[model samples]
Target: MSEVAENIKTTETVAVQPKKPAEPLLSKRRKRLMSDPLDEDNPITVQVLGICSALAVTTQMKPTLVMAIAVIFVIVFANLIISVLRNLIPNRVRIIVQLSVIASLVVLVDQVLKAYFFDVSKLLSVFVGLIITNCIVMGRLEAFAMGNKPYDSILDGLGSGLGYSWIILAVAFFRELFGSGAVFGFPVFESLGLAYENNGLMVNSIGAFLIIGLIIWAQRWRNGYVEHN
Candidate 1:
């Protein structure tokens, strides 16, 4: 009788206790947030964000690489700051707050580039400052960082920044290869002893546009992404 009573008491205790949530190193949704933007949800190719910088800075691989690193630094830090302060920001002025955070990070990036990469910074010029207005940084902050935990926001920023980085790097690769017959100022054509004329059009802003558009098209097709009517 006592054993039966003790078993009933144990059963009641277990029934009343709440189940603990899973605490893995990384949740499934967090991983998705980090990875999806790399391809399927890419900010540039899929969402079509941050096209101006892609066109402006992609003429040469050197400057383009510097710009990509700068953007990644700015975006990751900005997202982290905003995510940590997400709940404290007022709704009426949230946009302003986000912009301020982004602008500060951009300044930090610009200064670091100027200090460490003076020549590349000169090549970049106003474009580095213009990162303050980049839609990708602001968009991610508002959409993902604002609503997510700091770790998830960091992943989202890293993914989005890389998404933009790889596309621009590809654009720069082609532009430098065909436009100047070189990659990062090394004469590939000359080194190979092959005669090749640099394509003037490939060094132009229009070339960046065409390349990025074609890349977006190819990515969408590969990913089976279609627009709705």
Candidate 2:
């Protein structure tokens, strides 16, 4: 009887022993805030979105840098605003609300650019207006921002924007030096005494395209997406 009671007690203790729970999945808001930029999912290099501005504004180092900063500002703020008002936005008209928010931010950025840097603004021209149509901006709003907190969405937007900017600036450096015979608007090859009196390569848009293509190619090669053979 004593042996049977001891056995029963042991079985009860084993049955009552607690099982550890699995770790919880990351929250929607946390996932948005912590995503990386250089992976296969990057908007610029991988997804091939927003290449128009990448080709247009990257002719000169300064303008390319400025455009990149402007994009970062617009994307971060737009995401923050959209996330904040996500619940209030009607499902039927969510897209319209998102557009309204993005458009307002773009206009504000344009106004600031015109007020302080009129010449650069003129050079940018329609490109600045086209920021509203940048796929990354809209994509974030639909994918991550709408379901996340304002702070997390903003960080995600800013990271992607800066990732795009860094690539653009690198492309501009090579384009400006080789194509323009200049760096940051300073003529560096005057002593060469070249036969062509003018720096003709920098002025054309096709030059921008070539520089961007080479950069994308080089990046792909380095990442093992393309082989030297």
Candidate 3:
């Protein structure tokens, strides 16, 4: 009789135990949302958004790195704010509302940069203010943030920011290396005891355009992305 009671108690305990909840961090959809923009669906390389700053600020890596961080902050916060307010926002004024949110964030970034890192902020100049007009930030807010949950919108913004960051970083790396014979202001060629002449063109705007064009071509070819006639 005691053995029968023990068995019943064990069965009841087992039956009452709850199952583990799924890990939101490891969800397939979340992974895809973050990873897709790094390559095939990249905002800059693939979709060709945010190219102005890419060309303007990528003359050196340090300033480019700061700009990238600023952009990431603006995009993620803007997306979160927009997503949370999507339901409350009026349809007719959605564009205006989105612009307002983005502009506010851009001002905050600009002020913070001015307060600290003033030199790099000065280097970035009007480009930092121009984040307000970035199409990537606006596009994601309208297309994804308006419809998605806050968490998903944040991830989309992050993926897009990172996508833009990497491409510009690559451009800066090459430009600084060949253009100034340095990386991040360090005299790389000088340290190596090699006499290197900096390429005048590499430091100029045309160099940025050429590098971006090659990057676009290489990425598209590798991904089998082609214009359909």
* C-alpha-based local distance difference test score of model 3: 0.88
Which residue pairs does candidate 1 place in steric collision?
none
The root-mean-square deviation over C-alpha atoms between each candidate and the true structure, in angstroms, is: 9.5, 13.0, 10.1
RMSD in Å for candidate 1, one decimal?
9.5
Which residue pairs clash in candidate 3?
none
Judged by lDDT, which candidate is best? Answer: 3
Rank the candidate models, highest lDDT first: 3, 1, 2
- Candidate 2 clashes: the total is 0
lDDT of 2 by residue, 54-129 (tens): 8788888888887888888888888888777766678899988888888899999899999999988887888888
How big is the positional error of residue 44 in model 2, measured in Å on the Cα after superposition?
1.6
lDDT of each: 0.85, 0.75, 0.88
Ranking 1 against 3 by lDDT, winner:
3
| Cand. 3 TM to true fold | 0.89
* Model 2 clashing residue pairs (backbone): none
Q: Write the per-residue lDDT of candidate 1 for residues 173-196, one digit (tens) a residue.
A: 999999999999999999999999
